[model samples]
Target: MATVSEFVIERIREWGVRRVFGYPGDGIGEFDGALGKAERAGEGLEYIRPTHEEIAAFMATAHAKFTGEVGVCIATSSPGGFHLINGLYDAKMDNQPVVAIVGQQGLDSLGTFNQQESHLERTFSDVAAYVQTIVSPAQAQAVVDTAFRTAITRLQPCVIILPHDVQGQKMVEPGPEMWQSRSSAVAPSIRIAPPLEQLQAAADVINAGERVTFLVGAGANGATAEVLEAAELAGAGVITSLRGKQVVPSDVPFHTQQLGLLGSRASYQQMKDCDTLVLLGTNYPYGQFLPATGQARAVQIDLRPEQLGMRYPTEVSIWADVKATLDGLLPLLTRKEDRSWQEKVIADMAKWDDELTAQAEQTYDDGVNPRRVYQELNKRLPAGAIVTADAGTTADWYGHYIRLHDGMLGDLSGRLASMLAAMPYAEAAKFAFPDRAVVCTIGDGAFQMLGMNELITIKKYLSRWSDPTFIVLVLHNDDLTQVSWEMRTEDGNPVWSTSQDVESVDYAGWARLLGFNGITVTEDDDVAAAWDAAFAHRGVTLIDAHTSKNVPPLPPHITFEFAKNTAKALLSGDPEGFGAIKDSATSLVTEGVERVKGALRRDDRDHGDDGS
Candidate 1:
């Protein structure tokens, strides 16, 4: 004699879901009350109630990304469902499997314009791969199954809407083999390979080229070894997209960090100069950074067929799983003996690293350079750590500085590019892998938006993690720096102070108030000390890095158009701010002089002699 709510929870648990991220409201009272009873009985799913429904959905999406599990989130109707949209879009745009269960006003009040009434079906139609509402208890079990299956199979968000009254109904099971319908928990196991002809065609394009650049994306997850082996055979240098940043280890000789606006000069050069481009598991949308349409012969492998040739025109496109396709195609690729192209890519990466380090080390009179905070973070990041960053200059610094060692994990809201995801992502990562260290880098705006309220959620759940190494790095620039830079570069206008500047708040003080080990730093020398102290603690730490907004998030390879717009903006107004930007820019340009000197010294030492 179980209630429909209880039956639904049991069904999801059978699908291997142990955690449910959500918030409670009167709309979902039946489910919430049942969950409490089950928890008291020691049979309920582990429920994590984030401060806001939006964060609950964010946690669910992040859970899917970090754990490769079908993440589940629940919310009440109308406003609660409305808040879940942004986070649901994060999963949809990034292609993660997430299932959301939303409650609605009673079925009897369908057309009554009731309080908290919502037409969740029409609202969720776009974000969900499959969305359905259950009118009967019999539909509860099957609806959950379909939602989860669709999420896993398509790697997209799916929705299940339950009216408040429907959840209170008694669970029903169909009598043996009648006209009554039922569904099972079995989901399809998916690992696909493109046809031999497709794989061979892709191989032919890659094998025939003298210089190959492999642009890896998020789809390459769990296929790093196969990718590296193929790279060696094709004599290709590696360039990871932002989402694919962790696919290749940071230390690989020919593996350029990332490619695009927040990428490396090495990656930019390799993409521009390469004769062949082999795209793996990534649909990197920035075509401008890629070779001009027909400059290179290209082969693309993606799970989605529509993505195959949509971004960059490909000579051969394969619809297949990245690892499976690579497994079949590896033997066909010809191994190249020439190492010159790869060596040059490695050298360019070294020079870029030097320049970036110089940029990070540049002193600021007003505040600590944000680049320096990420640089220091990279230096101190523990082995096998999980890193998450908010959207803004935080992503730029993360892209440039943090070199994710092998086994390390890092991700963000890439396509959605939303804020307030960093803290939730970090918390989800920590929950998924309690033994691992987790870090979140966020800006003041994002941190203030919802991150502050989630501190209480984090503090409440602190005891759940065995390793207490969750660190939050908040950039206290008191400005929405990314938009400021965008206006300067894209619109050739000065920063609109009223819109761009954020009010200064004591970020560290709030963290301390919440019982986290909070530290505020403004000077260059204190950066390393702050990181060290945070690592040394046996609890969560928040480092309020008072960073300078003036130091622009410089693009890896600036186009002439960008340079011109930047110059125009600098001359327009805001001379004092632009002057600091000029200094930061100068350091990046002239840092190569030091790198050249160091390289020459190494060469002279190699040729010089004990023979002397």
Candidate 2:
């Protein structure tokens, strides 16, 4: 007779889960034994054990996001399960498919306050699309199957609770033949394209509007050509959610930039002035960034009907797959003859790009401007590199400076904005594609927080990867710069000593100790060489580039209210605060002036050409 745990593992393998991320613990002994047996026989799944359950969860999340496979993570009872929440939430908010299997205390001790006993179902309810507890061996197969299916179908986390006692129980019908048949017969969930009529309606809305803007999200993953075709037909400007940044190549003429706090001014202007807003596969949460109702008619297309117009009011809401919908709409689209609006948006994007370039080229007091660091990194970035950034200033730099090319996969903690996710995501990305270049840009404080320990996980797994170019680019400013900017701009307060102060560590030296090719760079002149070296290295590399602490992560559109708050903080008896404000203002104002001059020069050239 097969044990219940064996059936559970079989069910997971049946779903094509070859590798799982997790750590071993007390209540998971039976499952662990089954895993060990499978490994000994050299026939089944591989378990990747991270030091912390949290890292395991993050690794799983990253695996799902990068590979488009259902990621799995396992943990022991209460504390272990609890640690998985933050990473699970990252998967949930980003709409990635992942399943978490958590062990529980014996069913008999349910109400007796057993060791590490907690209601995991209730705890995981908010984060998961499906949550269930396996009470008996009979329920094991169904529960595991349901969890895997729900996770993939819903694109969210699914949790299954298995009590220690139930794990050891005998399965009624589980054997080698049963497992073999299950694995062979199981198929992925099929998704049908949206109806032709709905796609036509969306096209009609585009034809009716004079100036339409395409606001895309992560849902439009594989429909890049369709999107660009539609944009060309409609003469539309393209703006993306941070998650959708990789959808529209930054170098494209119609692509303005991202929208919202981390977005560009060109994106905001395009959205503000457009007569129609077409939302594709993105539930962009910031309604404020979108054109107000009555200002512009809106149309939303998404896979799920419930997400339609949830963020902004819509005229037509189409429920369908993004690629399929675009496929249907492309033929029906009435090509626009007038390209004035599109050209205008493109011109604005050029101006913004110039201003940004000017800012990036300027060296600050510390002789290292982080913007310049990103510019250099972006210039030297290898084709098809998988890039990840921690939440905060590092992400801001990536959004503002880096131009994602075609075939390059990039991920940030989109809605969750969780720190320390970048490093683990990079590790997972490298693991998934051992031949690809996987790089993580992280803040110093964030690197110190959770990323420091995960380096060991990367080091341990490095040997398995074949010629992996795994690089960790640490922005060593020794402070929580993003939070400091937030406190100043939002609360009108000087950055508290605790937020501004962090002990600087020799990150390169630390990585060197762990057998990685480590290089510490403090000069701006050495930035490019460091990147070149890291990307060229066959093994793991760490580039600890010390940057200026005073440089703030300025938003694309600076509001008067934010400026007022920042001024108040600067004047509120803080010398460092004043210096920060002055430096940021100088850089921005200088860039603005340069942009104006460039525009004037372009106008003069155009006039001179006409006269000639």
TM-score top scorer: 1
**lDDT, candidate 1, 64-164, per-residue tens:** 98888999999998888888999999999999999998989899887688899867899999999999998888778778899998898788999999899
lDDT of 2 by residue, 293-371 (tens): 7888888988767899898878889877788778888899999999999998988888878878888877777547888
Query: TM-score per candidate, in order?
Result: 0.96, 0.95
lDDT of 2 at 312: 80
lDDT of 1: 0.88
**Model 1 C-alpha RMSD to native:** 2.2
